[model samples]
Target: MNAPALRLALADDQALVRSGIRALLAGFPQLEVILEAGDGDELLAALAGTSVDVVLSDIRMPGLDGFGLVRALRARGDATPVVLLTTFDEDDLPLRAAEAGAQGFLLKDASPEDLYEAITRVAAGDTLLAPVPTDPVRARYAYRDTSAPTDTFSERQVAILRLLAGGYSNKEIARAVHLSEGTVKNYVSEILDKLGTRDRTRAVLKAITLRII
Candidate 1:
């Protein structure tokens, strides 16, 4: 038997953008937009009674933005995965979203296939992030000090960090590094510890900030 369609909740302050996304998603029969909200507050209220498989939220809403929404959902013990949509590739937002428990992040102009893949991946308990170029990441998030104290990662860990910033999954990273998934997981944990962050996304951001990768 085929799987049921996944229900999605969309939250964006702009009505036009929301409508555009809704129309775009309407083409995919496997996904359904069950609820729409203008901000995080409305999104949370709407989610209280609805069963949604994923949330696609704008990061800069007027009240209770995307990060705030993730925190709220986590506080309520709602494990519903969230995919933050943003127009700007802000340096700090990715780390903030990761800390707030967001499972996915994508640019507003991402293709339909990219959006679909992100939703499906996050729904399946995987994290997804839009690939950001390393130059812009370094320029936007890098600190002035070339020799920072936190720049202590092995060459293999640095390679893994680069893949992580490119949004590669643990399995994918394992394949790239020719290592087992379990070993890759250990490397990721070590990388996070070295960066003083708790998640892959944050580790990537910190690595960029410190020029570790």
Candidate 2:
């Protein structure tokens, strides 16, 4: 039997951009656009009456932006994955998105294949961030103050942090590190604790800020 089409919700303040994205996504047969919202408020209202596999939202919008949307969903105990769309490549944006519980982040100009992959991966309970944005983010955010107080990280933890910065999911990180997934999860949890952050993205940012990785 064939798998069901994955349902998606889209939110953006710009009508033209929304239309463009909708048109782009229409090419995929295994994906279905179930909801379109003008902003986070509309997206939240629409979500009240519908179920979706993933949410694709612009990071900047009027009256509740992408970060707000994710924070709202998480506060409501809605675990629906969110993938942030943005035109800017600022490192802080992805860090904030991670703090808000977003599962994916991508540039607005991401290719159709990258968009599809991000949606599918997040729907499968994996996190993703386009590689194009990650390297620049790391380069720009790399710690420079060697005198700053920093938490000590083991070499293995640093390796995991590098993968996290690259947006690799726990399973992928496991493969790269040659460890079981569960063990990687433990390492991730410890990393979070050491960094005093709640999620992987924030952990990476903290690591960069402190030059721990």
List per-candidate RMSD values in Å: 10.6, 10.5
TM-score of 1: 0.66
lDDT of 1 by residue, 147-207 (tens): 4435466657765776788677888767655689999999888887666776887777667
lDDT of 2 by residue, 101-154 (tens): 887778887788768877887898665533333345556876443343245777
* Clash list (residue pairs), candidate 2: none
TM-score of 2: 0.65
Predicted structure 2: lDDT: 0.79
Clashing residue pairs in candidate 1 (N, C-alpha, C atoms within 3 angstroms): none
